[model samples]
Target chain A: MAKDDDTAFDQAGFDEALRRRARMVEAVLRQVLEQRPLAGEIARPQRLIAAMQHGVLAGGKRLRPFLVMESAALFSADGEAAARVAAALECVHCYSLIHDDLPAMDDDDLRRGQPTVHKAYDEATAILAGDALLTLAFDIVADEATQLAAERRAALVLALARAAGAGGMAGGQMLDLQAADAPPDEAGIIRLQAMKTGALIRFACEAGAIVAGAPAAERERLAEFGSAIGLAFQLADDLLDLTADAGTMGKATGKDAAAGKATLAALHGEDWARRQLAGLVAQARALLEPYGAHAAMLADAASFVAARNK
Target chain B: MAKDDDTAFDQAGFDEALRRRARMVEAVLRQVLEQRPLAGEIARPQRLIAAMQHGVLAGGKRLRPFLVMESAALFSADGEAAARVAAALECVHCYSLIHDDLPAMDDDDLRRGQPTVHKAYDEATAILAGDALLTLAFDIVADEATQLAAERRAALVLALARAAGAGGMAGGQMLDLQAADAPPDEAGIIRLQAMKTGALIRFACEAGAIVAGAPAAERERLAEFGSAIGLAFQLADDLLDLTADAGTMGKATGKDAAAGKATLAALHGEDWARRQLAGLVAQARALLEPYGAHAAMLADAASFVAARNK
Candidate 1:
């Protein structure tokens, strides 16, 4: 383990870098949600645009976009291309949040301390906004402006679609719903979490490799790193749900426990969960050791995920 | 302009072709939705997969897929490639229908004489099913099985995203919801219809040219043909709503007028709408004149759109 002084230095650098990338992601997203219609578009409906903005522009840590940027930096990918892809990933993230917060889903009234999209705009508009955002993610990736080659763009689309589709996020959501009636065992919980959250985080890291045209070996390592951090991210989240308040989280916490959803954190107790998170973070860092200092920021990111309080 | 005998012959050929393509699309979709998960997928949740199949496998005209196949035939595109693209397009169409039938949206309980997705499954399952289907459309398009070049695949994804995004289908849904509160004028109605219904139809035609690698001029012409027929399809639908009963339509009829929504056929009387439909079909047929007999099936499709009773 590092000394306190070295850890402090790394924390400061990581905080600044995360904030910088978050701001960049915010700017790109703001521009993407502009009312001005793109070529071949008929017109942007104001109500829908406003709803999308409401769901997306609400502040969060923007950790997923940060992962994409830092991971891409490992291979020296073009910053502009990575930024756009990061924005696209954020769009998908926001879309899932909006849909998940629907009355039929998680039924949360607040997100990031503001009214959810359905509460801010009617349910119909919220649904449309989410749909549009998801569609726009693919649009952003495939558009010429992303600056990647056509093959790379198509590969990205395929990867994103797989991550977000039936056997991934949406399927995992169904599993979560089912778990309410019959909670799954440890393996089931792992699979459910992997599909629900792990898939997108893995994609975010792997997207960097794809954008940089990194070799398959590097991509695999980055993806493994993503999986490790993704596990840590979820474990930390479950811990926060148990330990943090709604005011701190800016959304409802303790609901997973209330709903009786099976989680590793809930199953194994806090001490075990914390120790596991530390191990996962270490594993994530080791996966990037081949890139040495070039991957220092990503290694720091793994620590941040394990250590985040909110 | 054709004699009664020639018209009968053309209609017979067109009907058989449409059925053949519809069956082909159904087979492709069934295979895509199999219980076996794809590469990188953790697992295919049975409930979600069943819901998707419920939404997609229910019978309909499959006109959109037929349009894709016929349009691709115009450019002599590979049959298998066109079939996959046609199946992908149908997925988007089914997703929109599933969503549109939600309680917060159109609220229809029935589609094609069967329960709507939300009725057959729960509202949450319906939403996830629609989301998964939409995501799968891109997956199918970007997958190697589509057999298109990388650039072409990227182009297809971009085009599909635009046609389905905020400024197109979802945007149009917003406009339609607003129209319920404050009905739009004729121009607004046209724009709404174009975005909601016309955009996808146009993409269906244009995708054929894209799959075949046809030149820009031909692509534009096919798109125009799609627009003409799209207008015809909506007009015929409105006319059917006014004239046909719920039983004939296999779903609710006259709901548009009941909801006080503005439509071209409702704006003008039946005679005027019929005249407009005739004129649009003529325009559509004329646009395909360059293809001569090779365009015969597509031209028949325009006539069918105008003349269909349901």
Candidate 2:
């Protein structure tokens, strides 16, 4: 482990890098969303665009986009391509948040310390906004402006679709819903976590490799690294749900426990969960050891995921 | 105009071809959905898959897939590639239906003569299934099996995404919702209908040319054919809502008027709408004239869209 001085320096660097990448992602997203599907005769509805912007521009931490950018950077992919892909991933993340906060889903009224999309807009607009954002992600990634080879772009699109689709995030959400009736065991909980959150994180890392046309071995390692950190992220999230307040977290935290969500942290006690997170972070760091100081940022990211308070 | 005998022959051929393509789309969809996103451990939640199947396989007309197939055939694209693309389009269509039928949206209880996905399953399941289906469409089209150049596949993904995104289907739905409060003029209604239904239809025709790498002029003409037929289809739909019963249509009819949707058929009398439909079909058929007999199926398609009883 790094000394306190080194850890603090790394943390500051990570924060600065995260904020910079997030800003870039935000700018790219704004530019992409500026495009209209029909330009000449038909115009984009102001209200729908407003709703979409509301869902996306809520100013969250933008962790997923950060993951995408940092991972892509590790493979020396084009910065523009990485930013475009990161923007696309952020769109998916924002869209999922909007839908998940709907009355039918998590039913939360708050996100990112503000009113949720469904709360800010009507339920219908919220749903449409989420749908539109989801659709836009693929569109942004596939655009020629991404400047990736056609095959790489296609691969990225396919991976993203898989990550977000059934058997992944959506399917895991279903499992989470079912857990209300009958909570799964630890293994099932882990599988659910892997699908629900881990899949996208894994894709974010692998996308870097695909965009860079990196070796398959490197892709696998990066994916594994992402998966480990993803698990660690979820464990930390569950911990925060137990320990943090709504004011800091930007949303209701205790709801997961109240809803009887079968999280790994719940399955194994808090201390055990913390240990697991630490272990996973260490494993993730080890995965990047071959890249040396070039991977210091990713190593710090893993630590951040394990240590984040909100 | 064709003679009565020729019309009958064309109609029969069109019917046979449509059914054949629909079946093919169904088969491809089933095969695609059979593969789990996480094969061994996470396992696709059977319930979510079931809900998706319920939404998709409930036996609608599959008109969109038919259009895709006929259009692709015009370019002599590979049958399998066309089938895969058609299947992807069907997935998006089915997903839109599932979402449109949500309680917060159109609130329809029945679809395709059966309970909607939300009615058959639950609202959350319906939303997730719809989400999964939408994600799955991109996955299917971007798959290696589509057998197109990567750029073509990327283009297809981008087109489909645009057709389904904020400026297209979802945005149009928002406009339709707004029309309930303040009805749009005739042009507004036409624009709404074009975005809501015409976008995907146009993409279906254009996708064929794209996959085949056809000339830009050919793509534009096919797109025009699709747009004309799309307008005709919507006019026919509005007329059916006024004329048909729930049983015949396999779902609620007359709901659009009740919802105060400002459709062209509602703006103009049914007779005028019928005349417009006829004009649009003629225009659609004329656009296909350059393709000669190779476009007979497309011409038949235009006629069928205007003439579909349900």
Number of the predicted model whose lDDT against the real structure is largest? 1
User: Evaluated on chain B only, what is the TM-score of candidate 2?
Assistant: 0.94
lDDT by residue (tens digit), candidate 1, A251-280: 778989988888899999988887788788
lDDT per residue for candidate 2 within B173-248, as digits (tens), equals: 8888888889899888888898888888888888888878788899888888888888888988999998887778
Tell me which residue pairs clash in candidate 1: none
Q: Give the top-scoring candidate (DockQ).
A: 1
**What would the per-residue lDDT of candidate 2 be over residues A1-310, giving only the tens digit for each residue?**
2223222336777888889998998898888676464431245788888888888876877877887788788888788899999889988888888888889998988787778888888998898888988998998888887899899999889889888888788888888889889989988888888988888888887788888889889988988988988998899898888778778776677888988887777777888877777788878888999999888887888888877877
Single out the weakest 10-residue window by summed lDDT for candidate 1 chain B.
Answer: B1-10
Off by over 4 Å in 2: A1-9, A35-42, B1-9, B38-42
Candidate 1 global TM-score: 0.97
Q: How high is the DockQ of candidate 1?
A: 0.89
User: Which portions of model 1 miss their true places by more than 4 Å?
Assistant: A1-9, B1-9
Candidate 1 chain A: minimum summed lDDT over ten consecutive residues — where?
A1-10
TM-score of each candidate? Answer: 0.97, 0.96
Q: lDDT of each model, Cα atoms only?
A: 0.89, 0.84
Cα lDDT of model 1 by residue, B139-170, tens digit: 99999889999898998898899999998888
**Fraction of native contacts (fnat) of each candidate:** 0.86, 0.75
Cα displacement (Å) at residue A208, model 2: 1.2
